[model samples]
Target: MKKLQLIGLILVLAISYQCKDAKKETQETMSDEVEATEVIVEEVVDVEIITFKMEPKSESMVQGEVTFTESDGMVSMSAVLSGLTEGEHAIHIHEKADCSSDDGKSTGGHWNPTHEPHGKWGAVEGYHKGDIGNFTADEEGNAVVEFETDQWCLGCDDENKNIVGKAVIVHQGVDDFTSQPSGAAGPRVSCTGIIN
Candidate 1:
């Protein structure tokens, strides 16, 4: 066993030496070739950056995130909601999509792209443009809401929805979908912007 281990170590060292030699050869090549190869590799990677944020509605703390390169698809999002009540509540993407400072109230109204009411998720005819639907919290009053939409742009060269300029609001109560514009979700407590 000792001899076999020693042999294995020697083989590994030999392979490593060969790799080092290849790296030196590449480094000695024309600088333009190296630069072109690097650019090609970068393009093959197809990188994307997703931004997200979470803001508590009341006293609860908020958490957000941004995910890139999941299963060869461009998907990124975030949620600023946590420690919510033990039930489902409406969470709409505000039309403004801007969550600057000041509690994000300047974000405007629910993202009603279709000009429809909220709470229309699974309905054959339900689902508002801004209506992503209610997120249910556990008994501990904590929920894991995420952000991901094709409406967003992944990079500077890609098309953008201009939603980064808007803000996301977590309603204390469910979306009533009664009134025109925003369902009575109450006030905006916490906020953060979707930045790269």
Candidate 2:
């Protein structure tokens, strides 16, 4: 009977040790799972977006809404316009966000933070940051414009790359690309301020 009792005690201790080891392993696994979840959360990226409306300028009937989305250091611009003539037109970012003027001149010249010459976007000869080129309007005088680039930011610290406190302008004619100063894109027909 004494030998049998000793054996029974030894068996209980072994079983208890196994249960404790399993519990410790489960806790370690849970800790590892929590760490992996934190890593996943840290890897997530943030996306920023801003949208505004375009008003008619320079005695033209052009009007539109513009949206700017920033993600992964790239900025994308989308504009939906109506009341434009049935043909090609030019769009660009201007120096100021002010659109209080009647003729859209309040927005000033093209946004040339780099002080580069006016030319086509991605031109080897150099171009303004705002040189967005052109888009065509449908026979119904409506148009949609989409532009994307990594050279721009929204309310960032880089003054040369940030697009806040700027203006978007729609011109009455096509961008000549070779014209100095403004590409001779004709009169500013629509204007909108890009604010925070």
Candidate 3:
């Protein structure tokens, strides 16, 4: 009877050890599969990249370069600007590509293909497609703007939401996010045309 009991215990211990080993192998295999899938997905979702070079206007020292990436039907914009005062500055997209004027007015008013009223970017009502809100500069006269939106498109397929060939403007004052014709964002200090 003692020998039989010892044999039974040994068999149970062996089965338990085998089960743990099998579970570990399965977990490792699953982990490998997940990593492989992630790589494939990253390869499939290629982003479309576009760039712009800003020019100073009206004797202002403001200038910068901005890059826009389109992915998954969304556009992400990043800019590094310099020679700005230490305060918030409003930025928007204008109707034309021309920035020949000294005051940046040659770019025209805010891009408003939809003919909508001027308001904040995320406003539920009465907001222009060009309303990009504002960004703040540090004491060193430098500012970085990073924003993303699904409302704007890179190509010119949709006239109202298309940003390609339009002008980007950086204002001299903060965007109040209210008021008419551009949130009273003040004068255009920097301007650039977006292109592929």
Best lDDT among the predictions, by candidate number: 2
**How many clashes in candidate 1?**
17
Model 2 scores what on Cα lDDT? 0.95
The TM-score between candidate 1 and the true structure equals 0.56
- Which regions in candidate 1 have their CA more than 4 angstroms from the true location? 1-44, 57-81, 97-103, 113-128, 146-149, 154-160
List model 1 lDDT by residue over 63-94, tens digit each. Answer: 44323332234444545445666787767767
Report the lDDT tens digits of candidate 3 across residue range 33-120.
9999999899667778888889998788999998998887889999899999898999998989889899999888899888888888
Error of 1 at 173 (Å): 1.2
Model 3 clash pairs are none
lDDT tens readout by residue for model 2, 112-145 = 9999999999989999999999999999999999
lDDT of each: 0.60, 0.95, 0.89
